[model samples]
Target: VDGNNVIRKIPCMQLLPIILFLIACLYQGERLDHRSCEALEVILKSLHFDFINLQATQLEENGASSLLDMILYYESTTHLDISDNSGMGTSGWRALAHLIKQSVCLSRLDVYNIPMVGYPALSLSKALLTSRLTVLHLHNAQLSGMPIYTLVAALKVNKALRELHLTNNQLNSYQDALQLGDLLQYNSTLKTLELSNNALADAGNMFVFTKLPLNICQSH
Candidate 1:
């Protein structure tokens, strides 16, 4: 969905006085400054939207943390797309992890194109254990090494997630595939798994495909 079009469609009366400024900054592709973040926090407290898209808004660690903090107060948001915010780092991911664990309505999250390497991955992995998220997108999220392994470990026990996308994350290692295979064996709730563009070899693929159960609707 085009975020700008959605913003334009909203009735002006429903928006607070600061909403116009927020919209103008977003339309200009301006990085949200401290003042803007504060204004956005205020706007979010009163206005509720099921889906919120802040993709590529240049939300560095502080901005990301502030936005996620504001979102904690609004439980009506069900789907959140914060993908492509390259500047988000460990702090941002940490805040997101907290949000995932606390949110009552958030069921779908798109972190596509964000770098979730190192400790950030660990933070998110821990959150997944308790998160109510059903659909998660992590395409190109730098989940190559221990990150993939950690994520797989979490999914093994996570019963809430139903759809997972892990495409283009360089998950070709035999151990990584083994971990994922184990996840599939234990996780009965997952219905779809998308692993396109990864270099999982025949040996690695075997560990995944052979473990698929009839309940699993798709794996590609």
Candidate 2:
């Protein structure tokens, strides 16, 4: 069935708030930094909306918080794509970290190109310690140098995660690649590990390549 037709089949009164919010979010071909928790609740209860895309929304800290609230408070949302939200700042990342720490229902998270560093990264790393996320995408989130180790630390204990994408974040150094190789060596639950588009020299890439067991590539 067509998606719009499926949406149309829903009771108008039940879906009105969600439709209005989406319309407002789409006016002028831009996603507004606005959210209604009431509307989100209605959508969740009525339609069981499980996926959300807030990509390139120009969302600031407040908007990001609101989105995080839905993921944290609601029980339905499992997959969220917040990629290219360059306007989201420290508060936003922190809020999401908090959500990750507490929410068990969120399984897949995408936050590519949303610069995060320092304490926020560490906090997020700590949150990943107990998170239920299975698929994680952090491409170009400036997760090189020291910050990459934070995630490495979490992956050491994160048995639930299955796929990790760390593309284009300059894993050029031997030490970082070696650490990642060590993680790949130990973490058995993980099936797919993507390190493409990085700044790795031949030696660095080769080091990680050598660490990955042949079965790691074929597991999933």
Candidate 3:
């Protein structure tokens, strides 16, 4: 569902308030150099149908905080994309955690290609552990690899999460790989797990060995 399209459908008489709100918030951060929040709020308000796309839009900590505020303020959202946001570093992930811990509505978050996420990966991991998520993607994002455990733990309890993607990440040490295998044994909700294009060696290969579906796992 395109909320933007629906927002366009409302009669001019009924949509004036929303328009005003958008104008007020869309660039609200321009002054403080942090307009992502107000703009995000506008986006949320516009989506009356289902699904919202915020993918790779360069949202920073300020915008992420605002998104979190709205999520908590409204008891969570269904879809969100935070990938490639140059501003969302360690601090931003922590802010997101605060909101995720409170509400379980966020089912998808794409934070790929973020160079500054290594330190904050733990914060995101913690959020996933306690919160409810269904889809998680962190492709090619810089990370300390600490969050992998949090991810492992979350996979066990995250009944809603069905897909996880961390392709090209640096999570391929022996211990980490083995730990992931252990976690997968208990993870019944996930249907797709992507750990490709990483530093997987023989140890890592053995971790997912026969467990991975033949369709998804190939080659040596």
Candidate 4:
């Protein structure tokens, strides 16, 4: 059988693995550039994958932006893991926020170790207001007081999010705990909250725990 004919015969559920295999073979240990990302877009445009992992792809700002733009063509993607891309800057982060707000099927996002302290955090918070995301992992993303406050505020009105991870974000202050406590009171959709490695003091922890629901899973 011809390779093209065999691929055409593959079921939709099985096609993702095959495509991922091809991508791995073609770009193993290689840094992705705009041209490479555009080529990838062409390859992926005709296919649908629920999960797209671009972790540690060595993506620079421009390359990251291009990759994000390419992902916009696949609205059916539900889970996106872009963790460990240390070179992504303002434009890349902004593009990611835009993608989140525009995505119709995205529900889970993992952006671990990305710097989301200032404008990036604010942008993501705004996107959360209208996003369909249910699980969000921002571990080690430098989410301290103000950033945490903004994100919690957004979550207050965002009914779609269910799980949130903010581990190692230096959330040690009472105000940080207070914001989270307030979130528990107003946001009913959040079910799992991970706060490990943070130094939330006894008072802070106590305040947040007081408002925590019995059914909700929480760690501090």
TM-score of each: 0.86, 0.80, 0.70, 0.86
| Distance from true location, Cα of 21 in model 4, Å | 3.6
Runs of candidate 4 exceeding 4 Å displacement: 1-18, 25-29
Question: Model 1, range 1-220, lDDT digits (tens) per residue?
Answer: 6545555677877544547666566625467655566556545765677787777777888878888888876773789888888787778888899999899889999988877878778898999999999999998987877888889889888989999998888888487788788888999999999888898988888779888878886566
Give a tens-digit lDDT track for model 4, residues 150-187: 99889999989999988898887578888989999898
lDDT assessment of candidate 3:
0.63
lDDT of 3 by residue, 1-220 (tens): 6556776788978887776565455433332135545545545554432344445555666666666677567653576655556676555677777766666567777766775345566676667676777778877774325566656766666666678887887777575676567666776667778778878787677767645554333332
RMSD of each: 5.4, 5.5, 6.1, 3.8
| TM-score, structure 3 vs. true | 0.70
Best by lDDT: 4
Tens digits of per-residue lDDT, candidate 2, 64-145, equal 7776766677655688777887766777778788787787788888878866578667877998998888988888888877
Predict model 1's lDDT versus the native. Answer: 0.81
Clashes of each: 0, 0, 5, 0
Better of 1 and 2 by TM-score: 1
